[model samples]
Target: MAKYVLTGTYCPDVLEKRAPYREAHLGRLAGLKAAGKVITIGPTRDLTRVFGVYETDSEAEARELIESDPYWQHQIWTSYELFEWIQAF
Candidate 1:
């Protein structure tokens, strides 16, 4: 599997919607973590951006996972981007 970086800007108004979906979102991550898919995940310091590092076989699959996330499904994100990371570390 390859590494990927998922990044996005949250909708300012997503706070209200986020509260309701946070649990479900975390639940999904917990499952991925247990399955050893996610490396790390969290929102930025200012909370404007959210990021996640994942191990996937393809960028297409990673993008699909992110697109299917509750936050994206519920329009909680304002803008987003995903990249296949070529890590030297």
Candidate 2:
């Protein structure tokens, strides 16, 4: 399995809209965690962005996961970045 880091930037003035979608967003992460695909996930302290580390078959698979997220679909996440990561620990 390869490791990936995914980053999401919150949409402008969309926290209110994001509330309704938060549960499903979390549920998706939980499902990924249960499947052993997610290493860790959470929003930044300022709530401006969310980040996750995941183990997946490939970078494309990781990209698929993020693109399919409800948060992305609903436009709660305005931008994203996915990168292969090397965990030194």
Candidate 3:
């Protein structure tokens, strides 16, 4: 598996807008975490962005995971970039 990093921007007024889908989004991430697909995920303290680490066979899989999330489906996440990480440490 390879490590991938995801950095995403939240939609405007995300704090209020995300309320409806937050639970489903978090539940999905929790399931992925337990399955070892997600390493870590969270939003910035200012709530403007989201960052996450994922372990997957390919970038496509990582992207699929993100796109499938309720947050993305519902527009809580406005946009994102994914990178294949070397994880030097």
Q: What are the lDDT figures for the candidates, one per model?
A: 0.84, 0.89, 0.96
List model 2 lDDT by residue over 1-89, tens digit each: 99999888988766688888889988989999999999998788887898989899999898888889888999888898988999898
Off by over 4 Å in 2: none
| Global local distance difference test of model 3 | 0.96
What ranking emerges by TM-score with the best candidate at the front? 3, 2, 1
Q: Candidate 2: lDDT of 22?
A: 85
For model 3, how does the per-residue alpha-carbon lDDT over 2-87 read when each residue is reduced to its tens digit? 99999999999998999999899889899999999999999999999999999999999999999999999999999999999999
Root-mean-square deviation per candidate:
1.2, 1.1, 0.6
Model 1, range 1-89, lDDT digits (tens) per residue?
99999889898866676988889888998988888778898888878888889898898878887887788888786677888898897
In model 2, what is the error at residue 67, expressed in angstroms?
0.7
Answer with 2 or 3, whichever has the higher TM-score.
Answer: 3
lDDT of 1 at 66: 82
Compute each candidate's TM-score over C-alphas. 0.90, 0.91, 0.97
Q: Which candidate model has the greater lDDT, 1 or 3? A: 3
C-alpha lDDT of candidate 1 relative to the true structure: 0.84
Q: What is the full ranking by lDDT, best candidate first?
A: 3, 2, 1
What lDDT is reached at residue 9 by model 3? 98
